[model samples]
Target: MKVGVVTFPGSLDDVDAQRAVRLGGHEAVALWHGDHNLQGVDAVVLPGGFSYGDYLRCGAISRFSPVMTEVVEAAGRGMPVLGICNGFQILCESHLLPGALVRNQRQKFLCLDQRLRIERTDTPWTAAYAEGQEVVIALKNGEGSFVADTETLDRLEGEGQVVARYLGENPNGSLRDIAGVSNERGNVVGLMPHPEHSVEELCGTGTDGLGFFALATLAAEVFA
Candidate 1:
C-alpha cells in the first residue's frame, strides 16, 4: 500500500507518521500541502502536528492548502482518509468530518499515552480492532477538545458514527468522550489521538497503534 502523508508549513509529526507507514509494510509518500497531487496513493494519512504553527486555531489555516482540494475529492470518492490530531481539526474545518476542535478544557497542552475504546471498527482505519477493545495511543495537543451541538451529538451516537471514546477519563473534555469519529461513508475518519506515535513497542506506548495501519491495509485488500 502506498500511504501519503501530508506536510504543511509547521507540521511536526510528518516524519513519525511516515515512519509508521513504512513500519506497517507500506511505502510512505511525502506530500506537500501546496501540491495538488496525491501521487496515486492507495490511502492517505493526515498526521498530527501544529500546522502553520497553530497560528489560526490549530488546523484552521492548513485546511485551505491546495492539496486539501484533492484530498477532499478523493475522500468523497470513498478513498480512505485518516486524520489524526491536528489533522482531525483540519478535517472538521474542511467539513469532511463534523464538529470543531477547541482548546483543551484545562487550557494546557497535554502529552501522554491515552487509553481509548474501539467503539466502531467498521471504518477504514479501525477494522483490525474488535468492537469494545481498549487500546492505548499517545496523544499530545493543546487545542484538542471536540465540540458539537446537541442534535449533532445525538445524531453521531444514534447513527453509530462515534468511532472511539476515551477510557477511564476524558483528556480534553471532548463531548461524550469522543476520541474519534467517522463520516457516514466510513472512508473518512478523524481522531484526536496520535496513533502513529505508538506504532513501535520500543517507544514504550506499545504497538497497539499498529492496528490502525494494519487495518488500513486490510481494508484496501478487502476492497481491491
Candidate 2:
C-alpha cells in the first residue's frame, strides 16, 4: 500500500506523517500542494501543520490548493482520506466532514498527550482500533475547538459518525468532547490530534497513533 501525504506551504508534519506511514508497513508518497494529481496513491493523509500560515482561518486558504482539488474528487469517489490537526481544519473548510474547528476556548495554544476514546472503528483510518478503547496521542493547537449546530450534531450521533471523543478533558472546549469524526461513507476522517508522533516505542507514548496508518494501509489492501 502507498499512502500520499500532502505538503502545502507551512505544512510542518508531512515528513513525520510519511515516516509513520512507512513504519505502518506502507510506502509513503510525498505529494506537493501545487500538484494537480494524486500520483496514484492508495490513500491520502493531510498531516498537521499551519497551511498557508493559517491565514484567513487555519485551513481556509489551503482548501483551495490544487492538491485539494484532487483530494476532494478522490474523497468523493470513496478514496480514504485522513486529516490531522490543521489538516482536520482543512477537511472542515473543504466540507469533506461536517462541523468546524474554532479557536480554543482558552484562547491559547495547548500541547499535551491527549486521551481519546474510540467511538467508531469502521472508518478507513480507525479499523485498527476497538470500540470504547482509550488511546493517548499528541495534541497541540490553538484553534482546535470543534463545533456544529444542534441538528448536525444530532445527525452525527444518530449516524454513528463521531469517531473519537476526549476521555478525561475537553482540552479545546469541543462539543461533547469530539476529538474526531468521519463522513457518511466513513472514508473521510478528520481529527485534532497528531497520531504520527506516538508511533515509536522509545518515545514513551504508547503506539496508539500507529493504528490509523496501519488501518489505512489495510484499507488499501481491501480496496485493491
Worst 10 residues of 2 by lDDT: 215-224
Tens digits of lDDT, candidate 1, 105-222: 9999999889999998888688889999999998888888999999999999998999999998788999999999999978899999988989987784999888888755444565
The count of backbone overlaps in candidate 2 is: 0
> Which residue pairs show collisions in model 2?
none
Q: Which residue ranges in model 2 land beyond 4 Å of their true spot? A: 216-224
Global lDDT of each candidate: 0.89, 0.93
Question: Pairing residues by index, what is the TM-score of model 1?
Answer: 0.96
Report the Cα lDDT for candidate 2. Answer: 0.93
* Model 2 lDDT tens row, 39-148: 99989999998999999999999999999999999999998999999999999999999999999999989999999998989987999999899999989999999999
